[model samples]
Target: MIQDYLRQQVESKDYQPVFYDLKNAQDLHTFEALLKSRPYIRINDEIYSQLRELMKIRNPTKRLTAAEYDEKVQAYLDGVEIEKFGVWVYYPWNNQVVHLVNEADFIELRTSRNQHKITAAEIAVLSKKKIGIVGLSVGQSIALTLVMERLCGELRLADFDRLELTNMNRIRCGVHNLQVPKVVIAAREIAELDPFIKVKIYEDGMTEANMDDFFTAGGVLDIFIEECDGVDIKILSRIKAKELKIPVVMEMNDRGMIDIERFDLEPERPLMHGLIPEVDIPTLRGLTDAEKLPIFSPMLALDNASARMKFSLGEIGKTITTWPQLASSVVLGGALVADTCRRIALDQFKNSGRYYVDFEQLIV
Candidate 1:
């Protein structure tokens, strides 16, 4: 009985944020109970601040008196009806309750600055799209950027690895998150950023068994981001993406090399831009991590890799554990991915090919 108790897994609900519309008597009761059960901080000032910014967006040409602005902000609140105003967000992971305006007003105020750049119409279209990112180390930054831009309504994250001290160099998170599953850390951070984004996690990582479901279970992903370390999974994922007509995007932290496979447009295109030959899933699956390194190097496009990166690769297993990655490179990769995915989803870029944003050559 003790062993069974110890083996029980944490419930998925704990990782997600719950909303409370205090106007509803039942939800209000639950909210009160939650506060009593766990130590929680109430944060409602942001809602009024949201109202203040929203007033500016609506009246961009006006320069009103302090009294006028305060009144304007109050006009939307309708005079202190906390129960009926905005929303009460309860995050179980951190036990913090945040007060936020309704979705429409919150988005308007939050993304107001993004106006001319993203356009209100584009934001609306992007909000309907869904993206899936596999692997959470570097994928963490990419996923966060996508959410920050409100580029997608939902994000599906998959990772079987947990945070470690070494990952701290690249993956952004507090040491408190050490040993926690990467998906959990990303989900909690996303929740804190925007409770509206629907995040689905595959703690078990991507595999042939769940690949189909991961791509389509919550509606076919508009874009799929692959950043895992396993060669077998990479091959398997592209095969599935091709079969499902989903475009796949990736970045190598080495030479700023970005790879895009427009399977949705060219169904017959070869995997890895014809660099990798036809592969047998079972055969690739049977290869161990050490054995898969030979196959993975080709995907790196070594001829373009920086000389230092080449030397670093040679150091693997001899002087170091594995390929080296820096926080800057990971963050840069994230930006490249988020921008590319957004453009593709918005129909701004087309065609399948390899591109590089290498700073070494461009900086000079």
Candidate 2:
């Protein structure tokens, strides 16, 4: 009976490889070449047209002939460093880039929408700021969104958890990624997106011993994102943030709630706005599910939580194994955190309070 049950469980599982492993030095060389190569003219006519479109240059308005456009394209390409290995990135992925461009040019092209909204000066300011993120499950979305928007030059990430089959519901990865450390996955994604930006990882996740290093290991953070479920780190991080005067942002990922604590402006502010002012790390650590629910409910603002989420919370460790999170909600959390961090870093707003992007209310 036991053997039959185990076989049934194994049969029910769906397993497939998603990402190609970098096995040898050749693979490394190809990846390096892809990172180093600059965007250059592959086919002259095609590249010329692309450059004209990208630059929004047209004849008769900011009139430039084909030759003139070609010259401009060449000038841009000249600035990119030549690939040392001359290797190309060829994987099972949908698209491939023969030549890579400078990080700045690539970012500029990718973040055109953001550029349109904010001034170049604002972007320059954002590029200089360093941001730290703890808990890569939902934090992964926030990190990627920040990178895509070019919000910061450096990112510090901490998460000791490994990716599991269960994490696939919200995390944007494939089955093959199971068992990979969350930090490694996030770092690889960021590096592939923009190699110029620096990423510091704490593979052990934030703890009493390493939490200090995560905050002040390399450079002081302009903004700190707290998303880990660890009750101890959650409280301890805020204490440190208050001491350093760094701004803090968090997303509940349930009911689309966002919490902003401007420790920078209000150094005396209690952790989580004093929601659990008396609860210390010792009391929080090693809490049972039943014991944790009381504190967790208030911290997440259960009174304001959606009906579905509130219902789900009640089922934890019962019918449900854990708190349920939707991909839509997780993705929304990323956008909320990114926008809040950007506004704070740019000094455009200094409000410290809780905000919501509740989908239930919004959709209705």
Per-candidate clashes, comma-separated: 0, 4
Across residues 277-362, which tens digit of lDDT does each residue of candidate 2 receive? 46666878877766777887777688888888778878888898778878888899999999988889889889888998776788
TM-score of each: 0.93, 0.79
Error of 2 at 194 (Å): 1.4
lDDT of each: 0.85, 0.75
Cα displacement (angstroms), candidate 1, residue 70, comes to 2.8
Q: How many backbone clashes does candidate 2 have?
A: 4
How much is 229 displaced in model 2, in angstroms?
A: 0.6
